[model samples]
Target: MTADMLIFFIFVLSIFLGFELISKVPSMLHTPLMSGTNAIHGIILLGGMLVLASAEGFIQHVAGFIAVVLGSANVFGGFMVTDRMLQMFKRKK
Candidate 1:
């Protein structure tokens, strides 16, 4: 009923929904999904920077830093994975 509890419930529900949805996706669609998620991660990275810019307290700053780092790592890792997947289809010279 409280705001924190509502957020927690929504977070838990999203985890379940996301897992169910991803588990059902065809393998052929994953490359496109990875690309899409990378774009979202880039947005997350931008959001983190904005959070860092607006942060007034040490805890907020630390949270923002972690968010930015993780978002950046996710974006780069997604790109690497997508590249490797694409490479699998290339013919050797």
Candidate 2:
């Protein structure tokens, strides 16, 4: 198989493994784990934004722009949800 196809297969396999592992976690751990993942997603969003800013040419620019938008949406939305969840645990003091 070609290198690209091999890489794609590995990516898919990793995603499948990730889901399987996550599924095995205790229910109470899900929120914390998801919060961490959202933080990582925010980092990805920043990277996407950087790429969009530095991209050259129309096609690359367009692709980068799309990536930035999608990533930013994920980052913002994830953080919002995480914040809301965390608030539930806050003390009233």
Candidate 3:
């Protein structure tokens, strides 16, 4: 198989693996798990940047831009939710 095909297979496998792993976690652990995954979303943002950098057409540029924006929103929103959850544990002055 070609390298691209191999990578695509790996990517598909990881998506399924990730979904199964997350689905099995207890509800109480979901927030922490989501917070952890936010970092992985940052890696997605990097990938989007690389795609944008190498983009060769208007459609590619638009798609890359959209990917980067979505990744950014996911990372930011996840952290915001996590921070709010953490604050719930703090003692108010």
Candidate 4:
């Protein structure tokens, strides 16, 4: 098989494993895990912004720009929800 095909197979396998693990996680672990995922999603937003800024062609630029905006909104919204969830667990002084 070609290198690209091999890589694709590996990627699919990894995704399957990831879903398997996610499905087995306890309910109580979901919040913390989601918070961590949101942080990673924020990094994705940054990468999307960089791509949008560096794109050359008009079509690519517009598409990348939309992706960046949507990604940023997702990151921000995720952080907001995660923050509120975390706050609920904090003890008052």
Among residues 3 or more apart in sequence or in different chains, the pairs in candidate 3 whose N, CA or C atoms overlap within 3 Å are none
Colliding pairs, model 1? none
Best by TM-score: 3
Q: Please estimate how well model 1 matches the true structure, expressed as its whole-model Cα lDDT.
A: 0.80
User: Each candidate's TM vs. the true structure?
Assistant: 0.58, 0.57, 0.60, 0.57
Error (Å) of candidate 4 at residue 83 is: 0.8
TM-score, ranked from best to worst: 3, 1, 4, 2
Listing every candidate in turn, what is its Cα RMSD in Å to the true structure after a full C-alpha superposition?
Answer: 5.6, 4.8, 4.6, 4.0
Cα misplacement distance, residue 72 of candidate 4 (Å)? 0.9
Off by over 4 Å in 4: 1-26
lDDT (Cα, tens digit) per residue for candidate 4, span 1-93: 999999999999989997887787778668877886775567677878889889999998998988888888878877777788877869877
lDDT of each: 0.80, 0.82, 0.82, 0.82
Q: Tens digit of lDDT per residue, candidate 3, span 1-93?
A: 999999999999998998887677878667776786774666678888899999988999999999999888777777777878767758877
Error of 2 at 7 (Å): 21
Q: Candidate 2: TM-score? A: 0.57
Instruction: Spell out the clash pairs found in candidate 2.
Output: none
Q: Find the number of clashing residue pairs for candidate 2.
A: 0
Q: Which regions of candidate 1 are displaced past 4 Å?
A: 1-32, 35-39
True-structure lDDT of candidate 4: 0.82
What is the C-alpha lDDT profile of model 1 across 50-90, one tens digit per residue?
Answer: 88889989999899899889878877777777777777767
lDDT of 4 at 72: 82
